[model samples]
Target: MYRDGAYVSEHVRPTTHAQIQPNGVDLTLDAIFEPLEPGRITRNDTEIGKRQRVASAELDRKVPETYYLEPGGYVVRYDEVVEIPEGHVGFVYPRSSLMRNGCMLDTAVWDAGYEGRGEGLLEVHHDIELERGARIAQLVFAEADHEGTYEGTYQGENYETPRD
Candidate 1:
C-alpha cells in the first residue's frame, strides 16, 4: 500500500522520476561503514580496508566509530524497525541507480512478524570504486493471507541475529 506523497500504490508511475518508482523510498547512506578501533579515528591506522561478500559479526562486538568505506565498496547501516505484519512478506532490492553504479545490494527475505533493527549488507560485483553513504537498495513491503496462522507453525518465532 504505497502512495505518492499521501498514498503510495503497489505499482504506479513515480512522481519523482521519469519512470515509475516505489513509494516510501529511502535515499543513499550519508555515512560510510568502516572498521574502527575503540570507535575513534586514529588517522594513521590504514589497515582497515575494503570488505566484500564476507558476513562478519562485528555488530556483536562493541567497537567505536572510526573510518568510512573506500571506493569500489558498499556499506550498510540499520534504519528503523520495520515490522512485517502477521501474514505478510517483504523484499529488499538494489536501486537501479546503484546498479548502474556497480553497487550490489544484499537482500533478505523477511518473514511475517519479524522484529529487530533492520540492518543491511553491502557488496560489490566488479572492481568499481564508490564512496561512503551511497544509495543501495529499496525495501518493498507486501501483504499476504495465511490461513490458520500460528496453528502449529514454526514461523512467528522471533530471534535476534546473534543469540547467546
Candidate 2:
C-alpha cells in the first residue's frame, strides 16, 4: 500500500503545506550540477566508482528564477531530507509540470531504510526555464518487505546541504 499525505508529513521532516500532495510529497530543487566526465557502473562490482565532481550552481529562491539547459543532462539535489520508514520504500517521480516543459527527471529506487537528501537526473530536451525551489518532483512511499535495511555505498549520503 502507498502512504498518504498525512502519514508522510508525520514521518518526513522539513515539510511544508505546499509540498504535501494527496499521495506524495513534493521535492524542491536546490542546486544543479553537470558531470565533468562520462560515468559508468559495473554490474558485477558492488562497489561503485568514484563520481566525477563538477561545481554546482545554487538556485536562487527569492525571485522568479530560471535556469537554462542546452539539451543535455544535469544532476539536481532536492532540498528535502527524507527518512524512509521501516518496511517501506520511496520513489521519486517527476512532476507533470516538468514533463510539460520538455524535461524529464530520472530517479532511482529509494531503498527501504535509506535516509538522506536525494538527487535525480534532469534531462532537458529543449531550453527550459526552471524556478528555484520549485516543486519539480514528488516522493512517494510504498510498503515493501526486505531482509535488511539499506547499508550500501550511498546510504546516509548527501545528508547535509549548504543551501539548507
Candidate 3:
C-alpha cells in the first residue's frame, strides 16, 4: 500500500504546510548544475563528470533568486532532506506545474534506508525561469519487501549530519 502525504511528511525536513499534498510531499529546488564532462558507468565502477553550478540572478533583496535557463538539460538538487523508512521505497515525480511549463524531472528509485537531499535530471523543452525554493517535485512512498536496507555509496548523500 502507498502511504498518504501526512505519513510522508514525517520523513522530510524543512517542509512548509503548502508542500504537503493529498498523496505526496512536494520538494523544492535548491540549486542547479550543468555537467562539464561526460560521466562513466561500468559493470563494477561508476564516475560522475565534473559539474558547474548554475548561477541564479538576484533581482532584488525582496525578490527570490531566479534561474533563467534555455531549452536544455540540468541537474537540480532538492532543498529538503529526506529519510526513506524501512519496508518502503520512495519515488519522486515531477510536479504538474513543471510539466505544464514544458519541463520534466527524472529521478532514480530512492531505496529503503536512503537519506539525503537528492538530485534529479531536469529536461527543459522550453525556455523557463525557475525561482529558488520553488516546488518542483513530489515524493511518494510505497510498501515493498527487501532482504536488507540500502547501504550504497549514495546513502546519506548531501547531508552535513545525520538527522536525529
Candidate 4:
C-alpha cells in the first residue's frame, strides 16, 4: 500500500504545503549538470559496479534563470531531501507538465531506509527552458515487506542540496 501525503511529508525535508499532493510530494529542480565526459557501465567487473567516471559541469543559475535544455540528457538534483523508512520504498515519477514539454525523467527506486537529496536523469526530446526550482517530479512512498534495509553505495548520498 502507498503512503498518504501526511505520512510522506513526515519523512521528506524542506517541504511546503503546496508541494505535498494527496498521494505524493512534488520535487523541484535544484541544479542541472551537463556530462563532460562519456560514462560507462560493465556487468562483469565487481570493481566497476558503480565506479563509472563521468565529469560534469553544473549550469550557472545566476547567468540565466532558466536553463535551456536542448535535445539531450542531463542530470538534475532535487531541492528536497528524502528519507525512506524501514519497510517502505520510494519512487519518483515525472510530472505531467514535464512530459507535455517532451521531457522525461528516469529515476531509481529509493530502497527502504535510504536517505538523500536524490538525482535523476532528464531526457529532453525537444528544446525546453526549465526554471530553477520548477517542480519536475513527484516522490511517492509505498509499503514493502523487506527483511533488511538498504545499505548500498548510494545510501545517505546527496544530502547537502536541501534547503534549510
TM-score to true structure, per model: 0.46, 0.85, 0.94, 0.83
lDDT of 4 by residue, 41-72 (tens): 56753331222222222556344356777898
lDDT of 2 by residue, 1-164 (tens): 99997787765668999889999999998777777655566785554334443332245542645565678888888877888888998889999989998999999998888888888999999887776678899989899998898887777777765763
Q: Supply candidate 4's per-residue lDDT for 114.
A: 85
lDDT of 2: 0.80
Q: Which stretches of candidate 4 lie over 4 Å from their true place?
A: 43-64, 161-164
- Candidate 2 TM-score to native: 0.85
User: Model 3, which residues run further than 4 Å from truth?
Assistant: 58-62, 161-164
lDDT string, candidate 3, 75-157, tens digits: 99898999999999999999999999999999999999999899999999999989889999999999999889989988878
Q: Local distance difference test, per candidate?
A: 0.45, 0.80, 0.92, 0.81
* Model 1, C-alpha of 126: deviation from truth (Å): 5.1
Tens-digit lDDT track of model 1 for 82-160: 4455656667677777678665778767665665445455665544433333345565666676554332222422223
Top TM-score prediction, candidate number: 3
Clashing residue pairs for model 4: none
> What order do candidates take by lDDT, descending?
3, 4, 2, 1
Residue pairs in steric clash, candidate 3? none
- Report residue 106 deviation for candidate 1 (angstroms): 1.9
